[model samples]
Target: MQMMEYYFGLISVVAQSSENVLFLVKPILPIMLRIIAPVLGVVVIAAFAGNVMQVGLRFSTKPIQPDFSKINPNPVRFITKMLFSRQSVMNLGKSVFKIATISVVAFFLVKKDLFWIMKTMDMGVLQAFQLCLLLAFKLIMVVSGLLLILAIPDYFFQRREHTESLKMTRQELKEERKLLEGDPLLRARMRERQKSYAKRRMIQEVPKADVVITNPVHFAVALKYEPLRMGAPECVAKGQDLIAQRIKKIAEENDVSVVENKPLARELYKRVDIGDEVPEDLFTAVAEIIAFVYKLKQKEAVNV
Candidate 1:
């Protein structure tokens, strides 16, 4: 065979002159590199592309992070899982099927070219190498095509299995919703209780007011003032509609003066809030009302 003759010639050259050995090897080195480089490049590219196809271009370092759970405490359970787990079983089945199919295909392919393969024994080294390279290229192409067909179904099956595994029961869904959003009924009840407490506090403030100003029917603003203790007249309580009616009733029961000033009541209700000082712009109007209330109280005291 040409291969045998080539090796024998190299041996003779090595024996004749060790310096000539480099000359013979120099040409072969480039040929070997040329033959191997494309296959290696293809393998590296295919591995990168396969990962990109599966999970896109996203990158994560989580897989390399130290995990206590990975340290199995039970050897028997770990061994059983490795041997009989669904993923492991599927992997083993796929490997066996691939090997059987490729072997059968390779066997048939070689048998078809048996005569041509045998004739390579009489051919030159380069011719025989070319023939083998062509056969290998065909074999790889067939194997890659077959695997591609198998991968389509495998992809869908894995996706369906993942979806099934992630499904939650009604109780689990409810718990997850509660964890994320809180209980709506409990929130509503708390809001109702808060409103009731605020109303009670506002009613209490009405009795402490020196005078309650009313818009006759719709609005009420209760103000308190003490020249020695406070800076200016402050709205102690304020409300509209039913709350305004309640404020008037509380003022009457407590003997606090109730002054009907439609414009003052509406302005105070709009511009000021409970516990806030009355604005300076309405000082003249408020002072007039306060003096009038004080005169009426003085007359009542004198009568008593």
Candidate 2:
């Protein structure tokens, strides 16, 4: 059983390898390195191409490498799986095809019975070995071709298995959607809570603001300037949507007057970040608003 297994394993490897090597056959000849370089180069290229087809060019630690013994062993379970499992069906079918091809081919060579093969002349051992080597290489190519045919179906099955394994289920889709967008009711509650939180933070910082900009009904921003941190106006608080309404309400409560300008409000929201300066392009419009707000504070102070 062990001898049978060892021989089977050897044949299986030869059959598989032959497929890849057959691709190197050139009616075409390159003048230089001939068989050696071209064969190695093609093997590397084909392996690379095959790998890319499987994973679309990414790197990871996953592979379908099976335990060495399970591939072909004297053991009954290994043999059973190889012959009875679906994988067995595929493998056996491939093997039978490859074996028939190799048998037919080897028979031709055997009948040619070129006594030259057995003729180990008094010629140097090196000369004799050179003859054997050529014959062996020829044999290898024939086997490789057979293996490649088998590998075609094997590659198809492997790809199908890989894709099926990685395909997402409906439940996975739903879970991913939930993660991206929280439940609508939950989202609504979060927005309200965030609005209230913003209002409190805005009011606490309102009196210290250099200016407050608004769309009157919908948007609001508060900017602060400090000489030491002194280069530009910084948004101390900014808000939109329902939160924009809340910010306007908070500004009113804190005696921070609001100015309504649709363009200015939209521009600030798009270009400025909280605690960051309004861009230079908006300087004229923003400065004009800041001056107006400052005048309002002075007028209120005078009235008081």
Candidate 3:
């Protein structure tokens, strides 16, 4: 319709003037630009808006990235496969159906309008032209609307197909999981090594302790205190069951005082970590223990 308008305008301008070709060209250029510019602008804006509505403002270079491995030098094989593929056949069928449906609809619309126009033979040329323009505009809108409706199903199908194509196989999924969380066997070994190192360090600290407080058999906590170096007695090592036995053995070997205080031992093991001072609530209990251990050491030193 816009093209027809441009052509009609050009003809009207030329018909009014017996001017030279150069003079005609000047008027024709401006009229052509005026008729074409708005239509072109509307088309460009509509295309951009439709794309934005479908997939909003995303920037990705993956689509444009070169993958030379996918390129086939032999065009014949590629073309044959492309044309005969199931997807290709389906697309061809859909295209043919759309074209046929739209053609049938457009033919009936034009035929009906033409019949009406012919019946009113006394209508002026300008009025007939206006009616024809209105019919053309309606035809364009109806066709576009039908195509847009058809495109919705195609969009969903394409999205599902793309997602399915990108799905990983079982082996691929396993490999990806390993990459994310590390190999199971290797992680188990790492945890075992960490536990062993911590146990060794705890055993080494037991011999340097001033006193080993015990839950008699269930729990053991070894503490060390130095007035000049530490503010309060700090648990140097703590353990339960077999580990408690090991701590007690090391303390005995080093001649460290072993005290049976089930409540204090359990409380210190639960509340104080290795290298941390006993809590303020246990200050009086720990102070008396430390003072007794110091007195015992002083008596032993005097006898030696």
Candidate 4:
């Protein structure tokens, strides 16, 4: 009412002189800012708080990223789902119930005060306005209380729906764990594949060996030496158990000399790797074996 009176006064002033328009508008701007400032401040704070509650203090552009999933390819099915789904039906029913209940409450409230409302016409305009305001306040309080009562069941229903939506399938759970901790099965398969390739490469190198030293049953270490290229004998292949058997078979198939030297084979298999030179501590023993093999090859050459 005061605002309406002020606007009416401003109109009267504008009618008298166009020059006075700026004077009236200047004061109104400050008053408008005073009214809007606190409301704007509250809105900004609430929005900030809501974001913090939902995702902590993190900042990301992902929320604004275009989501193609929201675009329905089957419009007919989308419309049917929107209108006929259980959730839609429940929401429609709740809206109808709320409107009907509020209408009934409002009707009865007015009916109870029907006499007092009728007497407002006989009272002064100011008194009638005050009575109307009081009645409107009462209606608002009652309606708010009714809505609060209705919200209790709604809160639990929404909570249960949210919980259901969050549930994951076994595959989804596995994928999520894989993303967080890495896929253990995939990692193991890769390791096994790497070992297989390594073993294949080692077996290939065995055919190039000058001599194979073996524990006779459990261990094998194949050595190679190129006098002009290599400074010392290098283990071309080394293995134990089944792999040892495989190395010995490969060496024998390639006609590489196999010397039964249990202690030398065990030490080489334990301490050396393919492509590594024999250690300084085992140099004397390895040199003796190499000399014997070379002498045997020379005798075979002379006989041929």
Give the per-residue Cα lDDT of candidate 4 at 108.
Answer: 100
Candidate 2 residues 65-175, lDDT tens each? 655653554578766765698766866777787788788888787556467676857644556666777877787787788777767877888889778768888988878
- Residues 125-180 of candidate 4 have per-residue lDDT tens digits of 55677788799989988997898788668767776876877899899999999999
Measured against the true structure, the TM-scores of the candidates, in listed sequence, are 0.52, 0.43, 0.56, 0.47
Query: What total of clashing residue pairs does each candidate reach?
Result: 0, 3, 0, 0
> What lDDT would each prediction earn against the true structure?
0.87, 0.73, 0.86, 0.87
Q: Which lDDT tens digits does candidate 3 get at residues 104-155? A: 9898888878876685467644566678768878999989898889888877
Tens digits of per-residue lDDT for model 1, 1-304 = 4654586467765755556677677767877788789989998998889768765797889999999989999999999999999988988998898789888988998898888899899987667778887888888898889888878877777778768778998999999988897898887898999989998998999888889999979999999999898888999899999999999999999999999989989999999987899899997789889889999999999999
lDDT of predicted model 3? 0.86
Candidate 4 segments whose C-alpha is farther than 4 A from its true place = 1-123, 134-198, 302-304
Error of 3 at 299 (Å): 3.5
- On TM-score, who's better, 2 or 4? 4
Off by over 4 Å in 2: 1-86, 98-207
Model 2 lDDT on a 0 to 1 scale: 0.73
Stretches of candidate 3 exceeding 4 Å from the true structure: 1-138, 145-188, 302-304
TM-score of 4: 0.47
Rank candidates, TM-score, best first.
Answer: 3, 1, 4, 2
Candidate 3 has a TM-score of: 0.56
Candidate 1: worst-modelled 10 consecutive residues by lDDT: 1-10
